[model samples]
Target: MERNLMKGNEALAEAAIRAGCKCFFGYPITPQTELSAYMAKRMAKAGGVFLQAESEVAAINMVLGAASAGVRAMTSSSSPGISLKSEGISYIAASDLPCVIINVQRGGPGLGGIQPSQADYLQATKGLGHGDFQVLVYAPSSVQEMINLLTKAFDMADEFRMPAMILADGLLGQMMEPVEFPEAKTHQIPKPWATNGTGMKRKHNIINSLYLTPEELEKTVLDRYKRYEVLENEHTEAETYLTEDAEILVAAYGATARVAKSAVIKAREAGVKAGLIRPITLWPFPKKEIVKASENAKHILVTEMNMGQMVDDVKLAVECRVPVSFFGRTGGMVPKPSEILDKILELGGAE
Candidate 1:
């Protein structure tokens, strides 16, 4: 297999194309603009459609349209832009449409700087939109994992008939690393519910989210939640490092996980029994893995490039069996490995 050194944003776009993405509709935003640019350059040649819509709202609605037609569609944006696209995201989820969303996150309460931050963990996993709907959220810590997971994001979106998000950060998006593409596998899922066209031979399939009758709407939402339950049970993913005899466990994801892993390794070398648990799926959240990884732990530290968002999840996952603490940075600032190592040492009582 051959490997190419590529920026994370470009690698993600290429991976989506390889995953059979047929339509790309996105507006340019800092940190993630390269992904849309790559899609624009390559999508036409791949017999796919790439359009830069007038706004993030337009872009996401376009994705909804393409998804209704049963094509693999996607859009990319940064943090604020994602907020603009949230309503359409809810529509897609409520309509049971399948599409991928890429969020190369930046700092933010409003139009924050274009530097890496994992502050959007709550938005992606909890409140992507105003509804009782969930999108599959994958957090990639490396450029290579970004490629691998983007492909899986598309597949899983189709499999579960819902939207999926690649929850990446600016550091991962702008970084360069060697990545190998997987052999292209054909997407073979049949979309019999698609509103493509009936050809007058069959009844038209309507793509809609509005249910005027409250009971009908409740039924539809309930059914979607049932699918979500199955997804949670079977699809959660996490990575654990040196956790067997660990007395101190660290939980982090995406770019922060990369830093935390380094810290864990340093803590171990310094004679601390430290471990790291990196959640790959932020929605399902790998709670089971975190629980198991922290079972033998005396202290658990949750770290992120935000104000302790994931710490809540980590605490809930372990059910306060072990004391949970948090370390973080925000507003486009990233946590350093040495800082995390210091926190680990403090938690391990090695300092």
Candidate 2:
């Protein structure tokens, strides 16, 4: 396995291609535009389709169509662009189509700034659209993790027959790091429900999200949740660092997690019993791991590159067992290791 120095966004594009993604439909948005550019330059040579759609909504719908036809498909966007694609994401969820979406986040409530932000945590974890549906969300802290997760995202999407998202920040997209791609994987079995030319042997397969009857919709929603439960049990992923004897725990994810981990090491070196629990999968959220890590912890500090979104989830997971505090940097500002270390020291003394 050889490594290559590449930007996170470009690494993701190459990873998608190696993962056998057959189509990429995306709109160019800052911090992530390089991803689409990479795909545009290379997809044709890989014998894949790369179309820069007119708009984010159009791009996502194209992904939906490709996935329904049983091909690996993907789309990438920033925060504002992701908002535009929400409707199509919901439709894909309802249709149970497999596709990958990458959201390299920027500050937002409405196009706030092009700088990196983790403000989309709530949107990605909670249903991003108008329904009771979930996308398996992976938060990658490093360029390597970005490539790794994007590669796995395709398989996860196909395995569950749903959309999977890579929730990255603008910083990760712009940073360059060494990454090794996994060997390309092939689908072992055929998708029988795919509407990829019936060949007259089987009846026409219908791919749709429209359930006209309320009862039918209810049943579909219930069934989808049942599958979500299975995913929760099987796909929860997290990383625990020096949590065994720690008195303070730092809960973070994505780029914030990288900074938090550095603070943890600094805090520990300064004689503070600090540790970190980084959620890799934001959807299932590794509640089991959080609870387990909480056993030896006295206080939990949730850090984010936004104004405290994932902190709520941390509180829910901790369940009043320990006090949860939040430290945030909003509007695309990233927290420094020294700042987080200071907070850890303050929390350590207070607790």
Candidate 3:
């Protein structure tokens, strides 16, 4: 296969177009703006529509509109921009619209910085919007993985009739790496519930999120939760390194996972039985793998580019069986491999 060096954000845009993305609606935000810019340059040639919406809120609603037509639509934004899109995201989820959302994360709280950070873990996994809903969230550690997972995100969003997200960060978005775009295969799934024209042969389908009656709303919510249960059982993914007989475990995702892998290597060279578990799916959250990895581990260190958002999920997964500690760098600061190695060694009683 031929490989090309490409920026992560641009690679993701090309991947989405190849994956059958028909429409893109997004506002420019640092780190993620490249993705939208690429789409603007390429989408029309691919027979797709690319519109830079007036704001993040408008962009997400545009995605919802496009998705209701039963077509692959997407939107991209950074941390604060994602916050602005949250309400529209919730509406899409409630309406059972399938769409892809790209979040190239940056420092947070309130427009913190343009540099990388994973502070949106809680927002993405726990409280994306003001509703009881979940979107499929994939965390990619490299440019190539970002391409692969974005394709999967489109497929899964269609399969489950809900939104899916690519949870990337500034580091991954801005960095360049060699990546291969495999021959594209058509994976567009059929949607029977779409509001597209019916050709007068079938009943007109309605796409809506509003239910005036309490009973109707309750029933709809319950049905959506059932689909979520099936999704949880079927599509959780994680990657483990050197955890077969390890005494210490480290949990991380996205760019932080790359650093954690290096730290694990250093610990191994020093004869400290340390291993790493990287979660590829942040929403369903690879809990089963975490439990298995924790079985023979003494302590688990959760590292991120933020102040310990994913640590809460790790603790829940472990069920308090092992000590779970957190080490992180916030405000656009990234944790160095040496820093993570020190934490691993300290957990291994080598420091």
Candidate 4:
């Protein structure tokens, strides 16, 4: 095992290289620009393909082109660039091509800010594209998860013949942390259930999600929903810190969770019985586990970097009588741990 103190962006690029990804296509975008730059410098030596496409649209199309050839491929961008890739993402999902799209999320709605934010949760899990298809969006809160999830993203894409996203934030992208690359197994790539080109084998198959007929489309949605249900059961993951006998439960993820962790510690120090629930997979959402906090707590505090995007999910999970409240700073402003602690204290005292 090798240990390296690398930034999350660098770790992602490195993990891609080690994951046997053969192509990387992306444009320069803040927070994630380092990932593209690193790929540009390393792809050739790694015997892979790396291109700085003219635009994110072009880049994701290039990803589509490579992935259709049955090779592992990827692209990275921030919020603005990801917007341009939306059409291409829809196409990839519709085609059921295997590929990875990394979004190191920033403040958004349009050109928001470069600071870290979890505001992309809705866009990633729900904003897959204009169609009824879904992308497997993985939210990595730490630099280590950035490395680990990249490999898992590639594997899942190939296994399910679907697109997977590593949804991160500026903090996870730019922060330097220790990560060890996992041992490689070349046969890890999924078999050709996905068409590289049928040639003489099994005839030509068009892997598309589009079905004009109502019945046909319903069947496709049903199949996709089944897969999503499997993901929910197998992939739902979360971390809890000190929820036993807690008066207030603070729920946060991505960079906000880092702040929430500190706040929880402080609240505990102050004897507030505050605790935290940090989600690792935002899509499967770990809602069941989070709701359990409400079973024992008087109130649940949802902190975020946007105007309460996650709070809605928290409320749904905790249900009405739990007194769910929201605290946030939009446009890239990250509230400090002390601020979060204060909010929790206020909520706890109210209870």
As for candidate 2, its clashing pairs are none
Check candidate 3 and list the clashing pairs. none
Model 4 lDDT tens row, 29-123: 89789999999999999999889999999999999888877789999999999989999999988777889999988888788888877787788
User: If scored against the real structure, what TM-score would every candidate get?
Assistant: 0.99, 0.98, 0.99, 0.93
* True lDDT of residue 132, candidate 2: 88
Instruction: For candidate 2, write residues 100-144 as lDDT tens digits.
Output: 999999988797899999999999999689898999999989999
- How much does candidate 1 score in TM-score? 0.99
lDDT of 3: 0.94
Best candidate per lDDT, number? 3
RMSD from true fold, candidate 4: 2.0
How large is the C-alpha RMSD of every model relative to the true structure? 0.9, 1.3, 0.9, 2.0
Candidate 3 structure quality by residue, lDDT tens digits, 1-27: 999999999999999999999999989
Which scores greater on lDDT, model 2 or model 3? 3
Evaluate all candidate structures by whole-model CA lDDT and list the values in order: 0.93, 0.92, 0.94, 0.84
lDDT of 1 by residue, 152-239 (tens): 8988899889999999999999999999997867464999999888989899899999999999999999999999999889999999
Model 3 CA lDDT for position 157: 93
